[model samples]
Target: MTHPFPPLVEAYLADLDRALEGADPRERSETLAAVREHTREALALRGSDDDAVRHLLEELGPVDSIAAAAAAGTPAPTPASGPPLADTLLVVLSVVSLVLFIVPLFAVGTVVWAGTRLRAGAGDRSRQKTALVIGVVALVAFLAVLVSHYVATA
Candidate 1:
């Protein structure tokens, strides 16, 4: 049996999906579903052929242009508004924790909080990951220094 979506149509959809990757999930799904439905309707009316699919995709315009239009229509908040609060806090705490080993418990708390936010996708993922890395490295170095100091004194 012929597939519901022709190979050309499938390729077009894949291109659209790639273009829409940065869009919100709901918007991306809605856009893709709408395009697929329109393609099916056109196929039904014009006959399921390569030429018809190509014509339809051409009329729809390039996928990158469509994505650009969608992104322009959407109101994405600007990073200039301020850095993400949780990520900023994570970085600060990581630095503080490194400088003041007297509060290892608090440092652990910061790591846990950053990890939670990272898992939840609540902050800048890269920033959170960097903060966690720095925190972990600082913690390890602090412990090593303490062990060496005690051994030397003994």
Candidate 2:
């Protein structure tokens, strides 16, 4: 189906609609309309460029997570006025660990912790995802370095 929104926004809304399958019809319709209206208003204010749309979707969070909340008859938490302190700390530590390469295991641990918090919906979703990505990249780089050292020594 054609939508007036940009492709990214259309795809996101489609995913959200799919995720809401099996939910109450009234709830599903209301949720979709609310989301569409919210998206339109945000785009009108922020501009509908790809980056802006992407950021909007991130703030909205994962489609499955939203659908799950709806199915449980719970309102999704509104975006926090500020990023949570724990989320900020974890993201900072993840970046520092990656840059320093001083504690590869600790970097991996922080990523895992961030993932758990993300799944439990305990912090800023976008920040948690960022931490996860940084940690994984750091772990992979650390492993590559170790492998190279072993090969060179042997």
Candidate 3:
């Protein structure tokens, strides 16, 4: 008999499929089916609450890791390397220069460019946090400079 899944389950499956994009077709199908079956079993045993679903997914770990394990016999895809030092430096410099009389737009642009690189690069938790913090601090500092300039000019 077919079982019905919550909307979140469908979304999760789609995300999982996307994560397994470059994997072998056969292995991908098997992995998807296995995950679905596991989800169904979890739903059956524990009520269909959001918490239960989250717990199940967490226990299964990330889809990328799962795909890698399934394809253990084959060479794994190259993981994303950490963000470049140049990108980090650009973000820091932009943020620090917020106090300069230069156009704020340039500083904002640099922060955005650096942030995109940090987010897109490999899953380096430390680097991600550093980039995020730097971005926020830069923005705040820039805004402060703008306000101060406006007040001074008036």
Candidate 4:
């Protein structure tokens, strides 16, 4: 079995292929491709050593579980989609507010709106957090400018 992949990887793939038997043709191929791509990426990043390959296989989990998921018509979860549109919009608005720090009211409003939405668990956590951070920075900048102006006038 002198294949390009390590022996462990080869065995794992073989077992997965067998376990996937009776699965839909398209699903089976897609599953195989996803597994292969994952393996390739891991090997490239972690090296092809036995220990690394063994760990990678562990992370992939048992081939039986994967086959079971496929049989159940739930393709293995993959990072195929981006954040929701609302989340993206929040992030964009946050950035815009940060850039237009002169508009202190708008920046403060954006921060409050983003914070409220985040607390309600309305959208993706990461994007909401990003929006919050940017909004806070904008608020801080605006406050500093206001203080500096008052001090200079006085």
* Residue-level lDDT tens digits of model 4 in 69-103: 88888977543435568778888888888889988
Report the lDDT tens digits of candidate 1 across residue range 52-141.
Answer: 677767777788876776666653221132446768888888888878765576468667877887766554677788778867776776
Model 2 clashing residue pairs (backbone): none
TM-score of each: 0.46, 0.49, 0.44, 0.50
Q: Report RMSD (Å) for each prediction in the order shown.
A: 15.1, 13.8, 12.8, 10.9
Show how many residue pairs clash in every candidate, following the order shown. 0, 0, 0, 0
Give me the runs in candidate 4 sitting further than 4 Å from their true place: 1-69, 72-79
Of 1 and 3, which scores higher on lDDT?
1
**On residues 10-111, what C-alpha lDDT tens digit does candidate 2 reach at each position?**
899999999999999888888888888878766664567788788889888898888888888887555544766888898998888799665697687878
**Candidate 3, clashing residue pairs?**
none
Give a tens-digit lDDT track for model 3, residues 19-124: 8888788888887887888777666644567886776567666767777776674532333334446655665665554544245565566567656655554333
Write down the lDDT of every candidate, Cα atoms only. Answer: 0.73, 0.81, 0.65, 0.81
> Which stretches of candidate 2 lie above 4 Å from their native place?
1-3, 80-154
Candidate 4 residue pairs in backbone clash: none
Task: Name the better of 2 and 4 by TM-score.
Answer: 4
